[model samples]
Target: MRFKSIVLVSHVTDLSGPSEAVENYLKTRSDRLGVIYHPFHYCADRRSRMQDYRGGTLLREARQGGWNLPALATYVKDALFTLFYFLRLGGRYDVYLGADPLNTVVGVVLKWLGLTNFVIFYTIDWMPERFSNKLLNAVYHWLDRFCVRHCDAAWNISPRIQDVRRSQGLPDAKNVLVPVGVDLEKIDLPDKSASEPRDLVLLGALAPSKGVDLVIDAFPRLKERFPQLRLHVIGKTPHDAVEDGVVYQPYEPRLAALGEGVILHGAKPHDEVLAMLPAYDVALALYKPSPNNLSQWADPSRVKDYLACGLPTIITPVPEIHKDIAALNAGIVVDYAVEPLADAIGRMLADPGQWRSMREAALAYMRSYSWSSILDRVFEESFRAKA
Candidate 1:
């Protein structure tokens, strides 16, 4: 059976990993899919830069603290555009899928305004509690409740987030857990490649929540045992500080000074990052527990990425990873503490035979999480049946 049409609305465009994954999934299965994405503000091309009409007003408001007039104006304009887009394609679509709270809100409002039919709200992470103050949190909580109650179905990246929605009293709640899946075909590993001298490689955004500091602290101890061991950190620094007086900056110089083997390669495109995965001995995922960490409560996307690359992982014992590690025997888990983390990395690196075995085990485990399998389930359970 074919969908009449599927409408996707998200803040991120096709350029982002999450958006690209979802878009690719829908495009592969259906010809009647259309997308309405928020303007891309970070594109370098001049023509593409003009596509984001929201930035001008936001920049002006950054100079002065109160209500951001320009940002509000941009949001209003986008909402209007969404309304027009919804009406244009409303009759042809069987379902509307939105990623994130803002997009969900827009979809719900458009539906309420008689612009569309079935609405599916996809939750990548928990919102309000993660990013809002007390008053805004209350408002967002009510908004989430409203969306969950009104939408035909809810799609969450993890079961943990589904629990959060269920607790909020959503009725007939169809919580579909759709964790990001691995594209096995894209992640090709070299069979007889020489391993880098590095003991651990941490990949993903270089934010505090990702626990870059923990890895840095752990590196010194790991280096003591294997003097030639190196730690390579790959990802972009945050543009602004999440905490007070703690500005985000590149960790290269600071980390390099602490040891001889710490190298920060900054952020590269997703394909480039995946290409380097095979060269490393182990993939380290040391995210600290935080409000912003919806993935910490659920399954992290990077764990699948690491496994797809056939690399043994050393991750903190987050609930999701803990369960997977035990079931799959894919990698090692340790406490988030520095001493244990260092010990875990050292243990994996010290034994080549064990490391090789774990690598094969990780690949075997990752086979079940290919995008085709996961997306097929998501389509059947979340969208097709529900609609």
Candidate 2:
């Protein structure tokens, strides 16, 4: 019944939704666990430099650095760091788990080095086909497939991803769909009187594919109806003002030009973000649908968090979220187009009774998706399975 240790490797230590899920599982469960994070070095540096605006500056810096390091240098750097880290700590763990493709590559190498008893690749996104460069994308695919082939088991966050792996010829028994879970006990419906203005809230990384710009574009039309409406954007910003030697633009000014309704809150602490959730009338998951491999296959963590808070969700009709909304009848799923989103928000605001009904259903659905419940099964079944 006891594991010697469970090691989790991921890209960053920041309070990302996926990292929070892993932390929740480790802290609440009885298992012995340790985490090793590979934070983006330049982003971390910019955060230390910029006193007031860390997130935005860091993101800009990351973009400027480009997605990949110069080939020979990256391989050498990753190899050395991976070797040193595993040599120091890997032997103590009975099971090693990696949270993304990058970490999975490292985990597979560590296993080859005989550093751990077993290795599990836990993927939250499919990255190979999502990268911009065809050549690099091919390389990423090869590494991803190599990792999957060598790993003992794979943990996927959505069935869409499991299907992708299977389609790529991976064995069915090697992968399990473990959608991200939320802390239902920590979230509850606050009194409506406590709600702020009928503002829309969007939370997550402000990257290109997140579709924040689309929401900004749609706001003017929305304002024609609800002039008092507000939009609160909460998450980390870019790392620098210059990306790839070009001046990086801030989203604030552009979004503000649409109207005075936009507010940029930057990144808040986990509890603070959750506390602020109930203050808003509706939660938005406005990411654009892309055939880009990652976007098409991944399940967004914010969707679960928004639903767990019992807030009515306005999200795009992405396959995974669409399926959840259809099954639970918990939230509204609209097309990625701004018109549909604007109209949906307007209708929900106009009909208080239906909005309340959706809110209750969302809360009910969240109860069954508690992190405690999900991790108990994950521990007993996946992590504990013999190699």
Candidate 3:
């Protein structure tokens, strides 16, 4: 895996989103000279800087508007800034691993400028429909297609996205399936908090599109069935705005005639969240399909976190993510409807043997998704190409 240099780039500098994967990937090759371009702070609630690209430099921008910009404007600015920084700061390298579409677009520009030998596009999720306005969606679609056309190789996270790119005229040879990876060391994590087992948990942003309401709705019925069932909601939110059974829904209507037994632990450190995964029976990741979820191959990192902890996941049909879970029988896949979700919960709770098997299967699946192997393959494929 020798090279002149290898760099990874992303639009966001926070440790929360795709940058988390970049950090974990760097851990596998700490000795290598790897640069990372992540200039802006996207998380205001926490000041979590991404891990420095040790043995190399971190290219950053001088201008940033922080996290308060309008959604469409934010992405537009991100793409523009990524191009600006990469053009100015990117040095000669063998590969520039892009952690997002916009950054991959920058990689394309870098390749055209001869700053890098190869541009590898690494994306966990994408869909043009994410933008609400028609014109904005058109701009996103055009920029994404530009990325698809120019990158030397693509590390697509979802099989569904592979299909999407194929339909959009990407050749089969240009794309490879590279699912998200987890730190294998997180498998048997020591507890950071002495918390009792929560029967159910959802640990991510509690935004409307995340399907938080469905989990809260399922809780009342789930508690009735299991008696000791309690739902743990952990992640970022707008305010201290949650009650036991009565949850807030700013984007959609509240789940009426739903259940209770909700406990809001709010947000915790990333390490703390992973540490607390062992104290939960099931990890809930209910991302509703289509418009609710903006990804063609929806990235459910929360699902990966659950599997890394050996917890059986209960997920909605989240595109390719659901298929992976269902194929391995790693967990249950239920409809977003409260009744079906509640039924799945009851089924898991009623059958301990099945639960154990699913937990085992989840661990087995994790064994195959090591970041070390994934990164090696990414580098190998990127450099060993015909170009």
Candidate 4:
């Protein structure tokens, strides 16, 4: 009812994370809902790429970015080529949405060319500090400012990110709080709970930023309290760069010393993880505070997933969900240290009554973070651009 269609642009090669969320939302709306959709992304293989999206197109120059300088060149080419692709579309879509700066640049240029009525730049996980050099960080900072200045609206995943934009001299009115929300169907809680549960799960990539080592280090104390508390690292290994970190350098060997309590289940399918979550008593998303965390840029999904499975969560300050975890009695949000983490989990497990109450609260809180509630606001704002 708002716009003719919405075009989402991202340079990400995978449709697994955020892209998968978008696709799930698309399935709910009908062709007559006037919610026609389009997606723009990178694909190294044209034949295999864009197969998931009916209206999506491949960025011909798009190659996965690497640590080398060619990665920088490949990104620049992707952004420049996206501009050409936009023009080639003859402005078919009414609203333009982009995930990162380069994609935002393409949307901004589309708006300038009168190809779209509104330019919505969705700021998800951003980490200028993750860059290897100062020059690249500085360049990304400038590009971020450019997007903030040019876009008609900002769809930010975290409220904290708005402060980052305002510091760049943008107004609060320009930024809309749009959480990277969860799909209700996919994240449904299993009917039955763990009968005699004493397991904890830390989901997501095993990265330095993710604080996998912090969890491991904190576990010696957690294990002392709950001897039956098995910790599951349920995700893939960190990026190649981070795998070389002191903590992750041959993580298996380092993890082996932690003993039989810790289980490293590398990267499971989405459905399997959801189903497996209720088997654990506590879910962990304890990211160590860093310039590279999703805390400021996006709402971390692991927390949402854990809650949807009706498991109380243990998290650090690095996730945007910490406040909710604290306020709603959902779970523990403790300092990123060994003693504090151990104390929190110890307190949580010591009281079976409190843990049961928090488990219920976790599901209730997760209801608010569903995508069904957020997508309407996203489209409502996009449609209002002309008004």
Error in Å for residue 138 of model 1? 1.3
| Candidate-wise lDDT, in order | 0.66, 0.67, 0.66, 0.66
Best by lDDT: 2
Q: Could you tell which candidate, 2 or 4, scores higher by lDDT?
A: 2
Give the clashing pairs for model 1.
none
lDDT of 1 by residue, 1-387 (tens): 245567777655222455557666676555466666664322221011111112112111111111223434544565555555555543335567877666788878767766667788888767436544566567556767778877878887777777787787754337777877877777878773334335578887676767788877877777777888877877755433344235676666567777678777877776677788877778888767655665565666777788888878877766476578756767887777888887777777776777787888888888888777777787677655454
Better model by lDDT, 1 or 2?
A: 2
Residues 193-244 of candidate 2 have per-residue lDDT tens digits of: 3333377888876655666777877778888888888888887556644322
Better of 2 and 3 by TM-score: 2
Off by over 4 Å in 3: 12-15, 27-52, 56-64, 83-92, 189-198, 238-261
Better lDDT candidate (2, 3): 2
Q: For model 3, which pairs clash? A: 220-259, 220-260
Q: Mind sharing the TM-score for model 4?
A: 0.81
Q: Cα deviation of 212 in candidate 1 (Å)?
A: 1.0
Model 3 weakest lDDT span, ten residues long:
45-54
